[model samples]
Target: MTHTRRDVFLGLGAVGLLGACANGVGGRGGATIDARVDATLAQLYRDYPATRQLADKSAGLLVMPLVTEAGLGFGGGGGNGALRIGGATVDYYNMVKASGGLQIGVQQYSHVLFFMTDDALQTFRRSGGFAAGAGIAYATPQKGEALAAETTTSLAPVIAVIFGQSGLRVGATLEGVKYTRIIP
Candidate 1:
């Protein structure tokens, strides 16, 4: 395909506009993020009651209230969240991701990471920026269905529950997502 400078600028401009539309970006502040986190958790527990058990068993939970993602050819996403231990907020974090491929869409979703083991929670807390890797297990539940927190998931150090997705995008995965602690 032939490339023009105009095409490049338009793509970049579109991405910038998408970033602005994302939730919890552009200095929304700690209180705003906390509110969203609480609401997200409430919705999660309501949708999948089984997750409450997981939350209780988890060493810590990182709740991302909303992540906004969009792409034409290249894409990126960002969101703010809170880390909770024993039902209390301990820290705030921001999640970000970037990708380039044959993709085009915009989507919004919420995800929570369950640190099943103290080691996993410590590893995440100690890191300057933590990226999701192979060690993490994903549990995506369909609407009105229970999360299958089986023996395998119990043994996994970290479990991720992704839900409340809405948009033109097809799927959501944390494969390349990175989490960093933020003051806000």
Candidate 2:
């Protein structure tokens, strides 16, 4: 199949629109992001109490209040979040993802990354852009279900919990998601 220049521009435009749907995109800076993070954490703890145990043990937590994703053939997602340590927001970040495949729909969800070790947290902070990879452990617990932080999970450098998903998108994964520190 032959592609035209218009097709390329249209595809790029769609991806840009999808990325803009992310929460806190044009919000009131750090304060707004922090507020959302607080609420998201509260809801997570309420829905899955066992996560609190993980939170308590974590060296730091990156709470992405809401991420919006959309795709037809190519897809992209974006969200703003805050990194909290000792229950206080220390820095803000932006999470972005780009992918291509057979996909069609839009979805919004919240996710949290728990830094189980100080070294992991430091590495993330120092890196120009940290990308989620195979090394990270993912735990998706159904509502009211317990998140078992077994020996293996507890020992993992980073643990991710995704929840409060709503929309038509079939599945959510952190693969290829890149997180960068942002002033907001």
lDDT of 2 at 52: 89
* Model 2: per-residue Cα lDDT over 3-94, one tens digit each: 45654555466678966563564557888898899899999999998888888888999999988877655668888999999999998999
lDDT of 2: 0.83
Question: Per-residue CA lDDT of candidate 1, range 120-145, in tens?
Answer: 99999999999997798888899998
What's the CA RMSD of model 1 in angstroms? 2.9
Off by over 4 Å in 1: 1-11, 22-28, 170-175
- Model 1 gets an lDDT of 0.83
lDDT at position 141, candidate 1: 91
TM-score of each: 0.87, 0.88
Question: How many residue pairs in model 1 have overlapping backbones?
Answer: 0
lDDT of each: 0.83, 0.83
**What ranges in model 2 sit over 4 Å off?**
1-11, 22-27, 171-175
